[model samples]
Target: MPPFDPLRRRLPGGLRAEHALALTVLALVGIAEGQRLGPGGRTTPALVASWLLAMAVCGALLLRQRHPVAVGWCTVVGTGTYYLLSTVDGPLVLVPIAALYGLASSGRLQAAVTMAAVMVIGVGAGALAGTGDVNGTAVFMLTGWLIAVVALGAMWHGRMAYAEEEAALRATQERLRIARELHDVVGHNMSMINIQASAALHRLEKDPAQAESALAAIKAGSREGLRELRRTLGVLRQVDEGAPTAPTAGLARLEELIASSALAEMTVTVKKSGAHDLLPATVDLAAYRIVQESLTNAAKHSGARHVVIRLHRDDAQLRLSIEDDGHGAPPGPAGHGASGIAGMTERARALGGALTAAPRPQGGFAVHAELPLSDNKTATERSTR
Candidate 1:
């Protein structure tokens, strides 16, 4: 067995080094007082009572982190009892300041303020009522220390709150990304299957071969859709089961996307006119999703028979356009029947890119995306690391 580390050991009453140090200071103060006043200097009862109260206050510091308010109250009571019996020229004054710091840092701002006010008044009262050599200078110094502790603790609390907010924002963004993925996968496949089912019914009596082919396409699309869904969900549950994994869809699979259109009953032509190799992973995935959503929208809403997908690249940017010879708009919002346009826009914007989807002046509808290749590549590479 390895040697034990004292630092890792849990001490009784949760007394870590800081608490132990506080207790030590209290013990030293008691000794100093005993020596200074000597055995027959003051009433024995008052001296003993003062020492006991100081001990109790130091002991209460053990639970400061978990129960700051309670510890603060105990320290207050102990300080008052000690000051009433003796004077404030001792280490017992330090206890209330430490308690106030703990209280404020633990998110008890109001309680800390109240304790500060009460301690100030108690110190003044002690000076006026006690029989020791207490004076106004001691009271002023102690009050200033109390204020500084509370200020530092409040600053610490503010920093913690900011960190919590940042974490929550990141969580919200991740959830939205997941939602977009689910929508793209399920929405596109369902649209294609719906069209293929209709086509199969129409051709059943006239052309058996074509109808059977349509059914086969629907089955293939459904299976592929389920596979993609599982892959996407794997990000949430990273535990490996006995399932085959595949790389995410990118521009290289443009042909496969076109072939899958056997379910759509529409011609989807692909054209590439740029350097397609060595694209960043994130850019590739976003491009695939934009095309997928565009095709799905066309298959569902456009009464046209042909769609075109074009990919172009330059020194600084990768551009893509999906145009269909379909009815321009369906008398509603731009994203008429679905959030496909919004999802596409969000994807492009995330990678420092821009996307525009509008009706063509002469004929159909067009979706255009201009993605900054340099920015996307640099950002994606950094994130992968």
Candidate 2:
């Protein structure tokens, strides 16, 4: 037994057209044979009645796909009566053939079995009593064709069910991925922003300038965090319509980040000595995020007020360095992140770049990442035009 598939179901009008065509052909052939039965029998009321009944049975197939079990049983019963009255040939048999498979595929094994039994009993009994087409090769051939149709319908039902299940599984996995990314982005930023906002609110009356600036930074950080989250969700959309093709936070936005760092209580410097060219969008965005996260970490965890951020580019690569004059080394995984060094490392690696953070023997923490330019050469990656 197979379940119904809404997506795979054929339209009602199409199914009706198919059934009507089959029955029309069957009826024409049947009427031709009856006309050939000689003048005495051709116009008999009993003969005419049988022909009309058989024609009605053939047309019954219009309901086959929708009510397969009911139609199949009705076909079996009507076919038996037509056979008894000697006019069940031609398109009349199509009703049973068309409806039988749909019955078997409608997720009702018991009903399918009952209909199958009726068809077999009706046909077998009629053939035995009337000496009909049972002994002919065509009988076996037609039975084989009908059975194949039933089997094919069952296969379709199974395949459709499997496809739906696979689609649902994929949707669940996507939801989980979105959940994880949102949690990582919001959890980290909200905690820091909340603390800063609470402090600013408490000091609003005492130090108006410091409180106002703190509140402003909180608002900016929160807005940026929301923007990043929205971008992540956008990736899950089915269509690319109206969505940004590339990330917005690239190297060009570095100055605003430096200002945020200064507000977060870190002394930040930006030094670019070489000519600046447009970087590959992904690389530029990664660079900015690396710098931003590092500065945030310094503000939160490091005792350092002084941080140096240098973006230097050669013909082949761009090197970004962030060093904090903070308390010794970060203790655990998030050590760099208390200021955001660990987050910076992750951002670098995600863009096919490499990151290294080591304790400065003289003082704070130093973070470095080397990103390859599209026109540049590196020992590991040689980019081509």
Candidate 3:
């Protein structure tokens, strides 16, 4: 069998030490009370007996915090008996603090309150009997210690509860972060591959060499993206994912994308305005995927024979618009019709981009997305990381 845990092994030894110390104190007080003093200013037989009795009662308290309710009641019964039977100090006066610590930490608010009330009543009764004087210093001391015990216990328990809550929150946030990263990986890569493959298939007979090139790019792109994905996941295991990827595809894929759709005899026109080069990887990937989804949907469902794809960029944003004379938007629930359009929107929104879809007045439908351009530094960090 495996060895016992260090903490658990130490626990029993610590408890034994505490119990032994309590008993030793009790025995010393008992013996001291039995000893005779040479002169007048010293202890009497009654005082000695009271101290001995108090020690014995206090010794019962060693396990009070471990079993609060049981120990507390034991203290009350033993202390009350000793007070009534012999004119000795009240039994178990050292127990209230331990019982209070256990009660507050238990998470049983009602039980703690009930125990507190019992302690107050028992201490009052002990005071009334032990000193035979209602207004005595012993009453004040007991009351002060009881209040301090309960307060300290409550504070320590509160700290422990807060720590548990913070840990849970951190775990939840980490899960959300991982979910978002995985979404980007799977969504962006698959959309591009599907688009490029469709394009290559369209011209495969006419331009066999180019078709082969596109096919090879598709394979290489997918492999590189998968490698990057593994690296992203490796962070969770605290392992290095090796090198980051520079999986080469940009605005150039738009031509192959449109040309492929044209192979299906669906005429496609692509237009660009302003400087569209050197975009953030995420924005570029999102733009490609959005247009890719639009073209794919046109081929899959739209009856419109002609398509228009427009790409535009200014200083702050990149714009993509795709329209076909195909049937206007799917009939009902997004999931029931085509799921890609909605997924594209979600992908765009993840990068602080916007997507819109609406029916055309004449016929068919149009899909467009505008993505924000984060500063260069942030984009570089995302790509390299």
Candidate 4:
């Protein structure tokens, strides 16, 4: 069940907190006015008029959220009229103060500032005219209170806007992450499957045995692609669900990845140094994806017959290099959605790492990535447990 919130709880007549606040202000103002007009100080008609004005001033707060500026002005005018007619002072001042807060909190700084200025000036003017109940000291206190309320409301508005901006930024980053995952998963397998299918078609009648092997590779690639796709989609579909039981793709699956490239008729070699198993999950996954994308690019774009993957692990970082002998392909548009290179670069940079893809001066293409191993020791310990 979702957590309970008092603000969300329904009040009588389906009223919310705003309605409750308005009613509370009304009651308090009414009681203060009643005390001011003790016994038979005022006639029945005058008493009724005073109560009606108080109700109107407080009732205007109900529509403050939707029409804050209008409600603010309404309360200001109503409160001014109440003080003008009524001989004694009451708590009717709370109504306009609430409206001012509503205006400022809704990002209406100009309107709120103007309303506050009007209230302060009107109170000062009344004091100078020796009117109803406002004295010089009352004007000074009222000015300070109005300024503080506007400042608080503006601060609240800024905080809320910052939170919304941060939420949007996080959402955009998540979408990019999902896009990269789908591209790497689907692109790598599909490239292998396409190569195998082409090979099978070419040798179908001429070499039936070789054709059968190619078809088998295509079948395996498709099945693996579908499994990975399902796993990815499953994680996407989860909402308040347990974490996925399947392990994420990482360097441990590097051998299987290299084996798949053989179906494309490419001889791929891996040269490694240091302990690869001690790498952090993020670094491991990034290294695996960099190699996978490089091989996929070679199979589809470059006419490469041989590829070399080199991994060098140190205490602080994991360095990866994937190079192909085939002539390098021209760079695609510079964006994650256009080519896998941009996606790989993004993944590396996201982990406080760096990646570069460039054609070799002699021939072919090479991709080099440096991924940090910031939390590898802790991650290794946790994995062992």
Candidate 5:
């Protein structure tokens, strides 16, 4: 058997489902009311008209989801009509409760509140005017129920709105993560390829051997760039097929990244001060991205001849600093490097770390990040040492 779906199986499907369920419950209640009245009381025309009005109000609730405010008004009007015409006051309040719930669920809090107020007022007026058998206790009980129903609807609306906002926030974060991955994979490799192509063009006629070496570097860079692109994009298609099995680039691949540098007249240097061990994968990936984005920016805009990347670690934190002796920021607003800086900042923040990229007072630009080490890994590192 198919799994039980309360919405689809136990209840009828589509727009009429709520109405159908409501009508069924009302019918069962009406049968019980008839049984209580018996043959002598049931033959009255007023009693028959009251039952008909109740059914009509229940039918009006069918339109509640699509036209909540109008349905609320209609429900109030129908209840008043039933009160004015019926000599007997049976339990006919279910219609208004259902209508109010629907109104509140549809995000019509103001209308639902107004209708609930009108209901309370109507109950008070009925009791005061000696309409049918409405009394003080009935009025008090109904007023409290109406207020409680309205409050319940408000809570449902609040919960629904909160859920929607959370879903939208998750979607936005996913997109930002994808964009950062693309920037890391594409930006660094493209800059190196551009630099190599420039070198090849400059030395093609004057020095054929150097030109050939530049071409070889270009070929290698292109291949590596393609592989990295596939690795990043494969995540999107992972549900359909397997993603790349190759390990992601981290500090372990720092040597290969430095060797692949083709920036014009720039020497990249890497310095380490502590043993690189027991770093969380998140911090490792974020550190690698910070370094990659920093290098890409320096290669593209900085007129510096040398860039220094320093990596260090202590008992509780891993620290990174990339400083370049380049033409610092221009005089105006933050320009082309804004996205890269923002991406790096977001990555650091996500991992409970901090990153800062700014023009140094010493005529250069610097990017720095401090990533935390997990407690378990810190203990393991101490034990191993």
Candidate 6:
């Protein structure tokens, strides 16, 4: 069944749903008042006064959204006056009940509760005094209705608040994910270009051919970096338009990544134990980014000449290990390397996985990550296609 949306009840001529509800309440109360009096009593002063009080009580509801407490009190006073001046038993009580819901939904819980208590007491006192047409049973039922309406309103308010908070949290996480992507793309390529430029300058005096190769590598890295940057920015700019159709980077480009690291004078090796394809897209992208960031840090901070990357896939999970023969922990008190590691850890945790980076006992720095492969139905389907 479709969900219940109150806004669908809008009347003709742009009348809001609340306005319709108020008019409906007014009509029902008028009918009840007519039933209470015969045709001979139609033109009586008491009936005229009762109709006026009912209109005032129901009309106040039109402003309930803007002034809930005031409208609630107005309905309460109007209902009390109607009962005191007239001997008719009618549905005018519903007006105050609706006002109580408005008050509770507006986060005015104290005022709503106080108003409900006063209403219950007033009805009970009227029954005790043998005034009006209210009895013990009617008062009891009205009290229950008032309590239930207030509770439902409070629950609706809480649900809306929770939904808003969840949306804000998702927006925050998306921004952080984009930040990590930018850092990986820009930082890695810039480091490679800088290193290649230095190499070209140093080799220009002796080996002209090697210097030209280094310059070529710099141009290639810059071009690739610009492509990736544009792709990431595209997602940010068109977020509200629709879903982006750009393909994300994945471990399928492992060879290209390794070649880029080699251009920076680092020998990178890849070892695979099992099938490496058919992983979920999210896990694949996160794994690729982890490797890219690790390589970037190695090129920029570590004086390592060799790095080994291992990928192991079993029935349960995919494991990644990247180790570099560098001066442990990337020198200096935790700065860029620390933030990079933190970002990697966040990515893994977001995917229900785990990642750790630290200095290996024997010599260099190592990063280990584990991503589960249990929920691979969708990924498997995509891979086969």
Best by lDDT: 6
| Per-prediction TM-score | 0.79, 0.59, 0.54, 0.88, 0.83, 0.84
A best-first ranking of the candidates according to their lDDT comes to 6, 4, 1, 5, 2, 3
Candidate 1 lDDT by residue in tens digits, 165-268: 55565566678788889999999888888888998999999998999999999999899889889888876774566454866788878777787764576799
Per-residue lDDT of candidate 4, residues 1-385 (tens digit): 2332322211223246667777887887777667656466765666778789889887887876557689889999888888887776777888788778766766788998999999999999999999747799999999999999888877777776765655565566778877888999999999899889999999999999999999999999998888778767665775787655566788888888888998889999999998646777778887888898999988888778999999999888899999998788666676422479988998888777889998898899899999888843322233334
Please rank every candidate by TM-score, starting with the best: 4, 6, 5, 1, 2, 3
Q: Relative to the true structure, how large is the alpha-carbon lDDT of every model? A: 0.77, 0.65, 0.63, 0.80, 0.75, 0.81
| Alpha-carbon runs more than 4 Å astray in model 4 | 1-15, 35-45, 239-243, 275-277, 334-338, 375-385
Instruction: Give per-residue CA lDDT, model 5, range 211-287, as digits (tens).
Output: 89988888988888898888888768747697697668788877767777633457899898986576778788888
Where does candidate 1 clash, by residue pair?
A: none
Q: List the residue pairs that clash in candidate 2.
A: 26-91, 296-339, 297-339, 297-340, 298-339, 336-341, 337-340
The sequence of per-residue lDDT tens digits that candidate 2 reaches over residues 69-148 is 66677777887677667643555665666566565455454565566556665565646666754643544565566567
| Candidate 6 ranges with C-alpha deviation above 4 Å | 1-15, 28-49, 201-208, 237-247, 330-334, 375-385
Model 1 quality (TM-score): 0.79
- Candidate 3 regions exceeding 4 Å error are 1-94, 129-141, 195-207, 239-385
Q: What's the true lDDT of residue 326 in model 4?
A: 79
Q: Which stretches of candidate 2 lie over 4 Å from their true place?
A: 1-4, 7-19, 22-30, 33-42, 136-139, 233-241, 245-385
Q: Poorest 10 consecutive residues of model 1 by lDDT?
A: 4-13
Query: Candidate 1: lDDT of 219?
Result: 94
Residue pairs with backbone atoms closer than 3 Å in model 3 (clashes): 304-325, 304-326
Backbone steric clashes in candidate 6, count:
0
Candidate 3 residue 212 Cα shift, in angstroms, is 1.4
> How would you encode candidate 3's per-residue C-alpha lDDT over 254-275 as one tens digit per residue?
7766655654557988888988
Which model, 2 or 4, shows the larger lDDT? Answer: 4
Off by over 4 Å in 1: 1-43, 55-74, 87-90, 117-144, 238-244, 331-336, 376-385
